[model samples]
Target: MKRWWIGTTAALMLIAAGCAGGTDAKSGTNRHDRHTSGQAMPAFVEQSTIPHVREAYAFAEANADQLQYIPCYCGCGSLGHESVKSCFIAGKKANGQLEYNVHGSGCEICVNVVMDAKKGIEAGKTLQEVRQQIEQKYGPQLSPTNTPAPPEGK
Candidate 1:
């Protein structure tokens, strides 16, 4: 009987620890957090769609203000430097020329947003409309209030 009581107590403790996130493995953080310390993006993305990728990056850079209204895709709680810059470097030369080696850590998200924005632009969707589409698609994962503001003017 005493052994049974001891076993039950240990089991309960384990269950409680797991529920409270006291286990050896922690799962709250993700790639975006890892990037916040100011890391660089990758150097190769889908080759066939460079222009589309560049457009998306351009859109994000142009709409820094709108970042406050959207979220990032890296699973980071809020927008960080890496997420924002990834948009700019998704697919372009370091000198802003055509470059095939361009890559970005958050390129997938940036690419998707950029593609959507380009489609919107081609469809005569204003910048605001395109931004709205991006927010609608990626907002839930982004931290609207945490995004940093851009320069003072333009």
Candidate 2:
């Protein structure tokens, strides 16, 4: 819905003033604060007919903070992907709205990773444990993006 995108756009604008290296009040992390949320997805992803594509995009959008620390084992690093989250989001637009990456729409591995992480987290698996399992399972056979490991004890 255009209304939802407008709201999401407005929300991102509020945080646009926070520059890179600035501390984000909500997370207290020392990094560039880019907008992230389950606001609204791009039309293609929102209306995707492929099985699990829409669901995965929604999951990635909603759980970006957690997904950011998980790596994509689908060889998207060549495209400058740093983590699983990168498979769905390229970056933010100058208007502060997110720029959706089209890579995930056609990549089964990307969606599967997102869903696996989602189900695992929902089933009480910690991010670290989930990352470990994903790494062991996919790392051995697939190309990994530049995803960083989950923080210790998290």
Query: Per-residue lDDT for 77 in model 1?
Result: 35
For candidate 2, write residues 25-118 as lDDT tens digits: 6656444223245244465665556678877877777788899999999898998899999998777789876778888988889998999899
lDDT of 1 at 142: 60
Candidate 1: 10-residue stretch with minimal lDDT: 33-42
lDDT string for model 1 (1-154, tens) is 9999999999999987666643233534332222222232223332334445544544444543443333345444333333434434333456654322243323565556555655765687555565567667777666432444333431
| Model 1 error, position 127 (Å) | 1.0
Candidate 2 global TM-score: 0.70
Off by over 4 Å in 1: 1-43, 46-72, 75-86, 90-106, 144-154
Please give the range of 10 consecutive residues that has the lowest summed lDDT in model 2: 30-39
- Candidate 2: segments with Cα more than 4 A from true spot: 1-40, 46-49
What Cα-based lDDT does every candidate model obtain? 0.46, 0.80
State the TM-score for model 1: 0.37
Clashing pairs in 1: 56-114, 71-142, 72-142
For all candidates, what are the clash counts? 3, 0
